[model samples]
Target chain A: MSTATIALLGQPNSGKSTLFNALTGLKQHVGNWPGKTVEKKEGSFARNGVTYDVADLPGSYSMSANSDEEVITRDFITSGKADVVCILADSSQLERSLFMLADYAGIDAPCFLVLNMEDVAKDQGKTVDVALLEKKLGIPVMMFSATDTKAYDQFYFTLERALKEKSHINVSELEKEYEKIIGYNEIKEQIKGGNISGYTPMWLTVKYLENDKVVSAKLKESLPADAASKIESIGLDANGAIATGECKFKWIDELLEGAVNKTKTGVKLGKLDRIYTHRFWGKPAVVLTVILGLLGSFIPALPIMAVASIFDVLKNVIGDALVSVGCPAFVTGLVCDVVIQSFSYIVKMLGFVFGVTLVFGMLEEVGVMARISYVFDNTMGKLGLQGKSVMPFLVSFGCTMGGAAGARVIDNWGQKVLTIALAWAVPCGAAWAIIPMLSTVFFGAGAPLIIVVLLLVMILHMWITAKIFGRTLVKTEDRCGMIMELPPYHKPKWGALFRYVFGRTKDTFFRVVKVVLIVCLIFYILSYGSGVNDTSILYKVGTAIEPVTKIFGLPWQLFIAFVASSVGKEGAVGVISALYAGGSYGEGFMAAMSGAARAANLNELLLANVSRPEALAFIFAITFNLPCVVALAATYQEIHSVKWTAKIAIYYTVGALILACLAYHVGLMIW
Target chain B: MKKLLELLKDGNSRTPEELARELETTRDDVLRQMDFLEHAGVIRKVPFMNESNGCSTCASCSGCEGGCAAECKGCVPQNAKMNMGTMWEVV
Candidate 1:
């Protein structure tokens, strides 16, 4: 049988392997290239009483020696081991897939182009004229799907013609494009055509200018010292790759100008994208969307909020039954105040958690969150940070620890520290849970209005904080540009979206329960026993700090809860449940003495004990406070500077108090 | 492609659509050029939230163990910014 060797070459996903498999069937052996990890495939097939040997070259983007696969592919084709090369391009996206053909222009190998995936191109409303492309390329070309078992006849026919004619790509047009590059002619003049066995002198010159290390070193070794020094002195421009790449792309576009027809689906932004990406309107539009989404969350939360009342009923039933059995007041207090009250608060907080997660998760699912990131990316640049800094800020919305961790993408230390500092201004998941829950408790139907105001204040807080820390933490010159690919909007996968929401909420429930129960039980025992309200260290310490805390409009109990929030936002809730329900042991004492009615629930207790203005101040306090001790550790872990981490922590704490003070005054005016 | 690089040198951020508009070219053309620039090392992909999965070790060189497809339970909540999509930066 007459045998001929052919190599299949293409970019990744260009259907090279599929064609290789179809051509060779089971007669294939896969092994690594000698001393290289890149896979080497060799096989043979007999057709029409003639044997054809197929070598599948490693798939790569181009002929440049960027990776082992690329080096091997280039070396094999130039080594003249293949009688003909079967170059493949995906017909569906020839604009991109043809890059391999463009880069392969100068190799002295006879080849034919196989426009694979013709079926997919037809599906996308694209049509390629095989005759026209063959004329333009001056090489055999066929358009057929690699998966089509019946299409091999055309492939084999084209291969035979390419072998018989010894056809090579028409490089006159491509060489004219390359000649336009600076120093192309000068470099070509120095390198002889026959010096490199497979690479043409024009190709060597282009690769040398593009700073291909292999090509440069090879030319240096072969050229006389004086000539080599002249070329070396020309130097590698940072834009060398860009300029050479532009030439190849321009040539590809010109070659395919009339050879390929595609439906005109122009890249135009949708109406929503227009507003969401507008230069001035983008920020306001994103801000408004987030506020509206937060308000929408309350709708889902209302049901879960209503469910929390059952805990109050359970608390009364359990408390009264324990009392009827002559159980001690301590046991009743532990069961009613600590266990039931903390769970009631946990359940309420979880409602907001579920609601907020669902709304935000749905936004992310439908691809609107990417727009939010795009909008804020510009803002990040204005803050003397890289666009990527916005990523950490976005993550902070979920958890400050995660945000601090996300800051690792920012390579600059100063910028990273500043990013973490500013990320602290964004409310974390726990703050979202607790803020809306408390807002509804204090403001009722006006909770949405409060959420809107908090979002506005958050924006203001981030700006002012950036101004304060930016000068020292980030340099103006340390900024760089970014390009983003906004994902197309699609229908939300409700199953996945809801699954994530429920999973997050469930996690929050378990995590919050542990923190709240522990914090609640500790504070409860500290305030238990006869007149311990007067004698307990917590009460004395809380009362002693009341004067200092009152400056922020926080009562002693709320102020203590504000302190507890530094450990965790849920700990603040635990403190509130314990302090309000236990109440200087007032409920039990009053029940024993004057038969005064016990507070109906924690809501009634909070309403009786804390004024609206004080409640508002406390909300602002915990909302902006240092997210948690875990976040602090994470910040330290990232920044690796105790000084900066401590500095950020102190700044956030002081800033939170200042915001609280301002919010209290505003609340007093509204009330 | 040259003009695309020049536009990015202004230290501003742009989405692919905006770049396509500014360059007076189709998004596919712009994307093709980006692919070339990326492979040629003229630019680099910005490893963002979706790739890193917002995990703590992601910001470090160690990378996520399973590279974002695997769940990194508890370190970062699942599905955080999973749809933020890809980003690139000029080298």
Candidate 2:
């Protein structure tokens, strides 16, 4: 019986292995190729009277000498070890899988094309004309499904025909495509009919242009020195590979134009995407989305805020019960005024936290936040930073520390520093929680207006901070454009979204409770006194600074809260809970209070004692203050420069007070 | 391909869909070109803030530095979707 060897070639996942395994069965043996770790498989079978040996080549993306598998596969084909090569491509995704065949067309081998996975292609509403493809390539072509055992007869017949006819893919169309490349003709002409074996001049020229090291080395040894230099001169341009690659893809499209039938849907942005991507409207669209998202957050928060009011009722009931039971004055005050009051405020703040998390989490899940990031990416250049710097700034809205940590993505040291510097101007998660609560308390129906104004001020603050720091921390040369692949909008996974929102709310609750309780207790103790004449240390210190604090429109008690906000924004609420309601910070202030005024809720007491202008000033001060000491530490850790870190920290501190001064005067003018 | 590179030269970020629209091509075609460009070192992916090379699991760790080593949910929300989108830049 006569024996013939057939080598199998295809890209990975092209069903090459399935066909190999089906043909070889248990007769196949696998071992590493000599000197390389790539697996080599060989097997034999008999059909009719002829013995057929199959060499299953290692699956690779292309026959480029980029890896051991590709090198070994191409080398075996050209080494004349096989009488025929069976190249496989997945019919379902021929656009991509046919790339291996496109790359292999110029190789000097007798090969037949196998459009495998015919069933999958049909299922996807695709019809591939095998005869049309064969006529175009001038090779034996077969539509195959290796998994269908009954199709073995057709496969055997095709194998027999391929071996007998010794067919090869026609290269006229492929060469025409390559000719469109700038250096292809020059290099092909230079290397025409060279002494190099197993490759045509056209193939060698293409590989040389692609900077294939192995092919270039082989040609350098085979060609005369002058011819090699001539080829090198034509290949010197670095863009040859890009041009050639584009040509190959275009050729692939041409080959499949009628051979494969399917709907060709070009990229079309959805209506919302069109608006969001527009140069003039993209920023506004993103900003509107965020503003709407913030407004939506208030809906979920209203119920939680109503629930928080129950805590206020509980505090009063518990306080009166303790007083009626003759509980000690200090114990009654601690339970009713410090701990209970702090919990009440904490619960109120948590309403906004939960609302913000759920709303923003849904936006992220639905893919709007990415567009927001993309819209802002170009603005990074105007801020004297890289496009990636926008990421940390967005993150800063959640947590300035995270934003600072996120700045590590920027490669330039100065841009990283500058990014963190501007990131600090973004009011963080805790500020988000407290700001809304404070706004609602002071402004009533006008709270949303306060939020809008605050957001506008935040934008101005970041812009100014970037300008101040950009000169020293970023270079104009460091900025560049980015290419974004926006994720498609999809329905949010409610289960996952709720899990995250509740988890974050729970985490914030625990952390806030601990800080607020401790801070409130400490402030309550320092302010506690027996009578109107009694002066605690906090009171004395607060009174001493009252005049200085008034420059920023803050009274002593509110000034102390503003100072405490630098520790943590949540801590400001704790200080307010103690100073305003616990009635120990100011001397004559609470003593002259009416019975109804003295018994009023903390909100009423705060609204009475702190004027609207002072409330506006305090809110601005806390919102723009250094996010927290932890954030400052995180900034230092990211930038690794204490000088820059201190500069940023001091800048924010002074900037916050200035903003407060401006907002206070603005509030006075409005009221 | 050269046209694609030229479009990015303005230093304004664009989505693959936008590029496809401008180039009169399909998204798949644009992506294939991007793949080639990326592999050829003509372009690179732009890593965003939360995609920083730091620990993504850490929610609150005070001791770690700013890279992935100190990843916290505080910086990156627990609900932050990883598939916000892919971004690239010319090298």
Candidate 3:
């Protein structure tokens, strides 16, 4: 419980968290960092025999104020108890770093700026004289390498000294001048009091000034009852307010003089920005990657299967050990059912994150994501989409959670809605897990074929919804604006890479394990309490559902478990395992299915039953139907509309039905 | 290990846990060096591993346990039938 408070602040992707972690080690706690899900990381560090508490605020370019980070940073500094505020800046991108620093000039805190990743700057032949910077900002500015202990130690001492002094060094008059643009006191209180609603007024003001369509809805919300007449009277569209905001940025530019300096334009800082965010390239790139993903699936699935098998072996062995230890049936299930299952799910998630994130991230980091926008950028024009709105759509491919997270990058509201709407179509991790489970258990060699069809249908359905949602429900705002940044493409550093896959997989698996253990215990109680004769009804239920399952050549028990799939993929797997002998999950439905399909020459039969192309389509239809339940709830949260959640659920359900029919009857005739 | 370090320094993908496991050591020991390497423009680090899974020799974070690091090569999809060649252009 150190009394000293230290704040680490920076713009998005500025390595602020890295510095915080370097300083704090495991002595950290995470919160919304002042009500922002934007991740507030605080840690305790003892240096010079004095322990200091450090708060790492969310990244923001400036407090001249658009995002919530500006509010958090403002609150932390204005609290008046903080000993020091460490502003970590990316040395490679000083202009951007300075942009934020320039905004912070209004805060009167003893600022010690750390120009981080100096190694990269030097490697690129960029140099900054810290003495020169220290003179420029009138603060103690240290060029640092967090990787090196000596430099890190020097930084620690700076924090130690700042804690000792506990002084508040105010900003210059130059910064006060920009306060009119970045300062937001009214919103700060509202946020702190938990009463702030929909983009703070100041945040809206800046966005409106920039003519950002994202907040056009909010702007309309802000208008008087006769807003339409006011707009008509002003002869201004949605951008009238935002246009005024961007105008002030130029005024603030004058205040930025002397405080900020550009060095050699930092070797094409804005280069490679356009080609990817290409009004045309952005969306097309998305399609191409998807096609590539489908193409890659043929080869990759085997390795994925191999990795999974390793877990199966471990689980079987562990289960036997638990049984031998005389562990109760519940305890045995707790270890094998919960722990092993959770671990397996975590492993699968890691595989997806790195496997998909790497490929997709490489494209994105290299500006390929922007290129993807090109193919579909104009698609927004048809439905009225805007900048940053494309983010959710682009993110939808990775997973819905990613799409939800990607929504953060959307600077405006129209894009947020568009991205979110499309995100519903993106099968989340749970859905991804279920399709594989169903396919492998049933289809065998045809598993990949089924998986591919489901994904395409999701995308097509998403596009239709985006188009419809834009035309009828939400007004579309399609502005061809691009954000450009040129970063030297390098290999991914494994140490720093945060694998969302692992987190998600871990989450999914835990959900599975916890619920499974609970369910087992509950069933254990029912079985013992109700007596074995009556308790056996659960098994009977697994058997009774078979006649309907026979249509798809699946076990009745699978359909029973699948009923639970709506809860989560893991829930389904857990239930399915419980139904089997020794409660084994056994082989997946896809593998079993493909073997059955091959023996009966079902592909040809399906072609004859429906149509040639419809045979493969039939398998895909069942696979794509309503993603497991976790995704449904997530979609509900992101859209924030129960009606729309149902709409998305129904859309997938219908999609699954249509495809399944097409695959079954058409395959009988065609193949 | 040196090649991996060089790869990381070159701003290539380098997982510290993988490298540490290969080096037969703890992740904590390698943590400082990885950061140092990153700071020195010797590597780039992505937050892909959770501590719980990163060192799990089982099919945990070290997903490619008991296998060649090269197995990760199959991660992305490609159109080139030349499966013999590298999928990622190893810079």
Answer with 1 or 2, whichever has the higher TM-score.
Answer: 1
| Regions of model 2 farther than 4 Å from truth | A1-61, A65-97, A114-126, A142-166, A180-199, A221-235, A264-266, A475-478, A530-534, A587-598, B48-71, B77-80
Task: Provide the TM-score for each candidate, comma-separated.
Answer: 0.96, 0.87, 0.45
Model 1 C-alpha lDDT per residue in residues A246-290, reported as the tens digit of each score: 788888899899988988777677999999989899989998898
Q: Over the stretch A531-641, how does candidate 2's per-residue lDDT look in tens digits?
A: 442577787888898899999999988888888888888899988888787757444345422222335678877887889999999999999999998888888777788
Q: Report the number of clashing residue pairs per model.
A: 0, 8, 91
Worst 10 residues of 3 chain A by lDDT: A594-603
Cα deviation at A262, candidate 1, in Å, is: 2.7
lDDT of each: 0.85, 0.82, 0.49
Score residue B62 of candidate 1 by CA lDDT. 41
Instruction: Estimate, for each residue in A353-387, the C-alpha lDDT of model 3 and write its tens digit.
Output: 33554455445544445445534444554555543
In candidate 3, residue A461 scores what lDDT? 70
DockQ of 1: 0.56
Model 3: per-residue Cα lDDT over B34-55, one tens digit each: 3323322333322111211223
Candidates in descending DockQ order: 1, 2, 3
